[model samples]
Target: MTSTDATTSMFERIGGSDTIDLLVDRFYDRMDTLPEAKTIRAMHADDLGLIRDVLKRYLTEWTGGPKLYTPEKGHPRLRQRHFGFAIGDAERDAWMTCMRGAMEETVTNAAARQDLDKALSGLADWMRNRQ
Candidate 1:
């Protein structure tokens, strides 16, 4: 890693709040339209407004940005929160399909995008609760 990369958080490396917003927006847009994403998309509410804001806050905190999520929601028991969903490899893949595209679109820094992709992939895998 470069000296700057070592010092900077992923949030800063990926362009902070603005890029995060773009990424989340693009991800949801993909989820809304992509054929492969239909099943996962059905898991969400008809009105995506609340979930969109929640995702923005969660990603902001997750990418080493400000503590935008925890102050209100506390430690993210992410799996527990998602236990209601029957997530498996297909669901994970569908989520990643949206996220990878969003990352490619908004995270201009190549290294940061790769790093975020790996991390997100892991997180998505962990989110899977079904066989």
Candidate 2:
């Protein structure tokens, strides 16, 4: 199903929790290995386990799936949570590159991919805290 199918949620259109987990995994894998992501990757812990779970929950909820995140972590307060990190243009771009790669690999629906691309780009740009 596609997001255009109003009967379906973005989460369902994108293949539910399993797909979200895979996307998060692919996203972090790219971030962990790509030279372009090295700077941003350095800000993360050596082990991605915790962040991976958090992201899975966040994405699940953000995509109109079950409200699994806020119940566990309260408000996302995303910008505030990321304030300590110096998220500049480079960081945002690298992050988007990873996400784009993941989405390309996992999301089969053209419209769903396009929708996510637009939404995620805006969200990533919003995360930038520096010039």
Q: Which ten residues in a row have the lowest lDDT in candidate 2?
A: 1-10
- Candidate that scores best on lDDT: 1
lDDT tens digits, residues 1-131, model 1?
34668878889989999999999999999999999999999999999999999999999999899999999999999999999999999999999999999999999999889989998999999999999
Indicate the residue-level lDDT of 57 in model 2: 98
For model 1, state the Cα shift of residue 10 in Å. Answer: 0.3
Model 2 segments more than 4 A misplaced: 1-3
lDDT of 2 by residue, 1-131 (tens): 34458788889888899889999999999999999999989999999999999999999999999999999999999999999999999999999999999999999888888888888999999999999
Cα lDDT over the full model 1: 0.95
Residue 5 lDDT (model 1) = 83
By summed lDDT, which 10 consecutive residues of candidate 1 come out lowest?
1-10
